[model samples]
Target: MNVYAQILIDEAKTRGITVKIIDEEANLYRLCYGNNSVLCRESLTEKTCAMAMTICDDKSLTHRILYKSGLRVPRQAIYINMTQAIDLMQTWNSLVIKPASGEQGRGITVDVREKEELQQAIKSASKYSEHILLEEFVHGRDLRIIVIDHKFVAAIERKPAFIIGDGASTIRQLVKKKNKALIQTTGGESQIPINTETERVIHHRNFSWEDVLPHEQELQVCKTANYHTGGTIIDVTDEVSYTLRTAAEKASHVLNIPVVGLDFLVPDFSGDDYVIIEANERPGLANHEPQPTAERFIDFLFPETKK
Candidate 1:
């Protein structure tokens, strides 16, 4: 478990909530309540336990159920073999390859255009799980919508927040300085490593990391807006439009899951249209800070149960 995960558990306990570390992998499993131990354990039957466990462990099934419920998700294909992956990408030259069962953007590759890169991405992503998802690359920003008990709780817009060079410092130095601050804010998850690919991207623009610096800002860096890749997260729950709310709520209803975090890619969620990228059962509640998603989660779990 990550630090944030542990913080969530601790926060729940502080609210007079009792949480047991069950061997089960369900993200948020409630094994009954009240002062009766035997009764609580007996209350959750095999079928109910299976259902709760099933939803949290699988992401492909989550999207399938949401799609049937009328949510606009990205065009994607689930592939098990290398041949199937190549065939799926044939239709779309550019696509995202990721593990169907992973979260927190682990083992996810975006803009895989060449066959070699595709194969590499597949091999890398496959390490996380047997099933892989090949999704059409949607040109838009990443939007995260948090839902609790059939209601929208919080929303955030994650944008890659990178600094450009002004022809002064080395890329390594700039990256180090940026990471120093990012680690303090994001608990060390947002620090982007200076790699050859990143340097190439800078070089492709006819610039070098040495030409840019802490003093002079000359060259532009970064093409994508992923916060995990040293981007910025903007709180936009108040700015979310009715369309986004409807899409998110409908997605939750379609999945038949009480707690969910829906991701969307769009020019603007306050606008008329957008694509419902995917739905997550074990959505990271720690991403939305200051708002305290853990508190909302505790409220959702023990709401009146504690009283």
Candidate 2:
């Protein structure tokens, strides 16, 4: 079972709710609190409309809907052909290429500046979906805001995967230790992949796996701030500004989804300026630990249980 699903089940058990495993393979479960029951496939429930889920699945459509609703979004365009993609890169200088209907930051390439890099990025994204999105790379803190029942419940900032030097270990040794720690922390769900991507990032910084980093030197191992790709999550619910909270709530209202996660690139959490990057229909309730995310989700589904 996914860690998030287990967390929900544990939370339900604490609330005196009856729980049954309907499908262990899919992590589907049935939870009953009194006469009220809900069938949940992960964090998604029947309360989320099919149409809203569909809209959130397509990145291009999500951007268009949010943009048309007067929300600030990054300049983006669909990748039609290599010629068009190159044209966009030449104009923007740096672009992010990813599958239009993918999640968990899979098959995403960021900061593509050259024609060759853009072509490679498209090929990478093509493996996941034929449809691709090319957008101007926006630089800012990656913030994920969780909205449940049309209200902001939690906010977190995701940072790229990085390793701190201990002055005694090689980069490869440090990575192995880091991965082990991550596995222990996330219950074997998340780890940093030591692959070409990791090598490329380190190579760009004039380092290698065999090289020893100085004490206290921080090295970013990946560019994308995705939890699945070894990114770190830091809770910022108490620090998020009203503007960001309001914007995320408005997005949930526009989509009419009872629960959603909004991704934004913001210069500062306290500032009003931000760019809506995407929307997630079934956000990871487990990612925001010790924040009552699963509790809020259960409450949203079974409000009668709330005191």
Candidate 3:
């Protein structure tokens, strides 16, 4: 079973609910407690409204809706062709290009500053979605807030993959060692990719794969702060300010989604300034350990089971 399915099953079993796997390939399952039962696919349950899911899946629509609701969101434009994408890039020197309907940071290119890079980003993003979005690149910490029933459940700050030098090994060797440790830490869910992207980032920093980093120096390997893409997650549930929590809750309420993850680009956790990046209808509950995300999800699913 997938990690998420296992977490949900374990949580349900603790509440004396009968758990059964309906489909292994799809990670589909069913949970029953007495006469009450619910069918779920991963973290998404039957209770999750289909309309809300649709709105969250489309990035352009999500930005439009949130912008209209008087919520702060980054400037964004959707384009279907290379010409349109390049023209949009002229407004901002640095832009983030991503698929309109994609997840897990797949087919996303960030911090694209040049026209050549922008063309490449558009081509890469086109693989996952026909419609692509170009948004002004905002520099801030990547924050993820899990809201259940319009209430804040958990928060995390995701950082890009990086490694500290010991003044001995090359960048390539350090990446290998780091990836091994990461696999053990995340059960192989995350690992830094040693590809063209990694190479570009290293070269831009005036370093090469064969070059040795100085002792105690930290070098970032990836650009996107995605957990599945070699990023690390730090639980910040206790640190999230009330202002940020209120904004996330309001976004969930506006979207009419009982369960959602609001991604934000915030200057800091203590400040009120932020831009809503996107809304995830079925946010991963397995990653936020020690935060009671799974427990809250179960509570939302079966309130009677709550202790």
TM-score of each: 0.75, 0.94, 0.95
Candidate 2: residue 148 Cα off by (Å) = 0.6
Rank by TM-score, highest first. 3, 2, 1
User: Which should have the higher lDDT, number 1 or number 3?
Assistant: 3
Weakest 10 consecutive residues of candidate 2 by summed lDDT: 192-201
- Point out where model 1 deviates above 4 Å: 1-53, 80-90, 193-228, 305-307
Cα lDDT of model 2 by residue, 169-270, tens digit: 999999899999999988777787787657767887899999998999999988789898899999999988999999999999988898898999999999
Error of 2 at 189 (Å): 1.5
Predictions: Cα RMSD each: 5.2, 1.6, 1.6
Worst 10 residues of 1 by lDDT: 36-45
Global Cα lDDT for candidate 1: 0.67
Global lDDT of each candidate: 0.67, 0.89, 0.88
Q: Count the backbone clashes (under 3 Å) in each candidate.
A: 13, 0, 0
State model 3's lDDT. Answer: 0.88
